[model samples]
Target: MAGSELTNIKSPRVKAARRLAKRAFRDRDRSFLAEGPQAVREALALEGVVAELFTTAEAELRHADILFAATHAGVPVFRVSGEVMSELAQTVTPQGLLAVCRFLHVPLEQAVTAGSRLVAVLAHVRDPGNAGTVLRSADAAGADSVVFTDASVDPYNGKCVRASAGSLFHLPVTVGTPAAQAVARLKESGLRVLAADGAGERTLDDVDLSGPTAWIFGNEAWGLPPELLRLADEVVKVPIYGRAESLNLATAAAVCLYASARSQRAGSESGPAPRLP
Candidate 1:
C-alpha cells in the first residue's frame, strides 16, 4: 500500500478532499467524506467505496487496527497533519480521521425492489441530522432500504452521514427520488405504502404489517401534504399516550418500522401470508 505523511494544508490532495464538504462538489465528483475512526473503518470495510483514507499522526498510532485493515484492503492511507485532518473533518474537535468515499446510493427503481420486505421512504425531509437518524433507525430495525425524496436533504450530506454513525454503509440507500415515483415503485413491487402522520384515523396497531410494507415519513416541519398522503394505501398515526404533542420524524419512523419488522417476523415464524379464496 502507498502512504505519505503530509503537512501542507494547501496541498492539492488536501484541497480535493475538503471540496467534498460541499454538496455540489460531492455531486460533481460522485464522492463524499466519511469522517472519524468508526465511519472511516466502515468505509474501508465496504468494497470499492473507500478511495483514499486520511489520518493524523496521533490517530495513526491510536487506531492502528483500522490503518492495518485499510492497508490489507489495498486502500491508499495517508498520514496527514492535525490541521489537514481538521480541514477535512466537519467536527470541531476532529477525531484525526477522514476518508474519501464514492457515492453509496442506488437508483429508486433498483433500491425499492432490492428484495426489501420493509422500506422507509422520507418525503421532503430537510434536516440532515433527522434524516440520518431515520436511516440509522431503519437499519437498526432491520429495514431493507431507505429512500430520500427529491425534496429531502442529501442523504450523503456530512451531517446526515455523521448522524448515521456507521450505518450509512450498512444498508442500501436511494436519494433524489420523487415522492410519487418512489411510492409507485414500492407499490408496484407489492408493498403497501403507509403514510405516517399525526391526524390519521388509524393507529399503527390497527394495521396488519405482516405483509410487505413501505412506510413513508414526512418532513420535519410541514409533515406530508395532502397529495403525498393520498398516494399511500392508508394514513396511520403513532399513538401519543403522553402529554407530548407529537413524535418527531425519527422517533415516528423507528416506531413504525419496528412494528412492521416485528409483525413480519412473527408472521414468518408462525405462518405464511394468508391466501384469498
Candidate 2:
C-alpha cells in the first residue's frame, strides 16, 4: 500500500476519484474509473494508464498479485473502507478494487492506417454496453482499431469500459471523430467501408470479405441514416434464416467483423471462398 487506508469518503482524493463517475468530470480530467480486478489488471498492463489504485483490505488480500504489480510499477495504491469503495465505484456491486486510468483513445489517422485490415466504426451508437460489446467483439475478430464517432457514446463511460472486459486496452480506439471523416480516412487507407443495416441491397454472406474492411454500425433503435449509408462502398445486412426479428447492434457487429476476419485469414492461406448465393 502506498499510504494509509483512505477511510474518509469526503477526503480530497476520494472526492476527485468519485467525480469520475460523471462524464463531464471524466472529460475534464481525461480520466475514468475502471472497476473490478479484471479492468484494473488490464489498465495496469499498459504503461502510465493507471494513475492510482483503490482497494479494500479484502480485495488486496484476494488479489495480492495485482496489488504487488501496482506497487512494483510505482502506482499509488490506497486501501479504502468498503463504504469508501462503494462511494468510488459506479456499479451496483463494487468489486472492492478500482483504478483511475487515463483516456486511451488515439487519433483517427493513427488508428486506421495503410496496413490496417479490419476496423469497427460505431456511428450514432448511444448505449454504452452495446458499444463496449462491439469493441470487445472487434478485438476478438483481430480488428486493428475501433472508432466511436462524435455522436457515439464515450468509450470511457464506466459501463462501456466494464462491458469491454479489458479489451479496451488491447487495441487502438479512435473517439469523437465524425462518422464521415472516419469513413473517408478508412477508404483512403484502402479499406472497403461497409455499412451494416437491416435493410440493405446485399447480405453478409454475399459480400467479399477477404480484403481489408471497415464496418460501420449505427444506433440500436434506428440504424444508419441515408447519408451514412451512402458513404459506404456497400450496405449489407445479416440474413435471418430463423424466425427472429433481428440481431442487436453488438451481435450484428460481431457477425460482420468475424466474417471479414475469417475470409481474410482464409484468403491468406488458400483463397477467398465462394460467396453463398
Candidate 3:
C-alpha cells in the first residue's frame, strides 16, 4: 500500500523474501516470513520485529488497520499481485498477507529462570507442525517458555510458524540448545524435569506438579532415548483409559503441560500438601 505493486517474483525484494523459505537463508538473515493476518498482526505488535510487509490489494483494503499500523511503525509495505503472493506464501492457498520478521528465540539460560513454574522442552522432535502445535499448547497452558533442542526442527520453519497460530509471539522460545544441556540447566534452576513417554514407569496422575516443572517431549515415532530419559526426575505417561493406542506428541504435550498447570494452580489455592501419615 505504501509503494508500487510488486508484480515480478524475481525482483530483489521478492527474491529476498523467497529466500527466507529456507533455514540457511533465514539463519543468515535473522528473519523469516510470517504469512496470514494473524501472524502479521502478532509480528507487528512486537517492537522492531516486522521489517517489511507484503499484501495484495484486496488484503490491504480488508486489513487497513494492520497496514496503517505498519506504516506508523516505519515498516515498508508493498502491494503485490495474487500470483506474486503465491510465490511468497507457503500455503496451498495464499493468505494474501505476509510479513518479514526478525527471529525471536532467546537463550536457554534466559528462558528458564529461577521463577519458571512451567516449561516445555522439545527433544529430537522433527516435525515442524508438531513442534509448533506443542508451542501453541504451551502458551495456552501458561508455560514460562518453550525450548527447541538442537535435534528438534527449526522453530522458524514456515509450517511451524503458521501452526503456532501467532502464539510464537506470546512467550519465550529457546532454539538450537542441546537436550541434555537444556535439561541440566532447567534442573539447576530448581525445576523438576519430567519426560513424557508411553512406556514410563510413572503416570501423569501420580506426579505432584505443584512445584516448578519442565516437561521433555521426545520424537514422534521413537520416544525419548535412554540417556535423555535418565536426565528426568521422572518419566511420565498419560494414562490411556479407552482403547486408543497412544496420543500424538502434540496432544501428549498439551495434556502433560495442562496437568502441571492445573495442579500448580490448585496447589497454590489449597495451601501446602498435607503431611503423609
Best by TM-score: 2
Superposed model 1: Cα runs more than 4 Å off:
1-4, 268-277
Q: Which structure is stronger by lDDT: 1 or 3?
A: 3
Q: What TM-score does prediction 2 earn?
A: 0.96
Locate the minimum summed-lDDT window of 10 residues in model 1.
Answer: 268-277
Off by over 4 Å in 3: 268-277
Sorted by lDDT (best first), the order is 2, 3, 1
- Write the candidate numbers in order of decreasing TM-score: 2, 3, 1
The candidate 3 region of ten consecutive residues with least summed lDDT is 268-277
Tens-digit per-residue lDDT, 174-206, candidate 3: 999998899999999999999999978767877
In candidate 3, how many Å is residue 135 off?
0.5
| lDDT of every predicted structure (CA atoms) | 0.88, 0.92, 0.92
Candidate 2, 1-277: lDDT as tens digits:
9567888999999999999989999999999999999989999999999999999999988999999999999999999999999899988999899999999899998999999999999999999999999999999999999999999999999999999999999999988999999999999999999999988877888777888999999999999999999989999999898998889889999999999999998885544445655
TM-score of each model, in listed order: 0.93, 0.96, 0.96
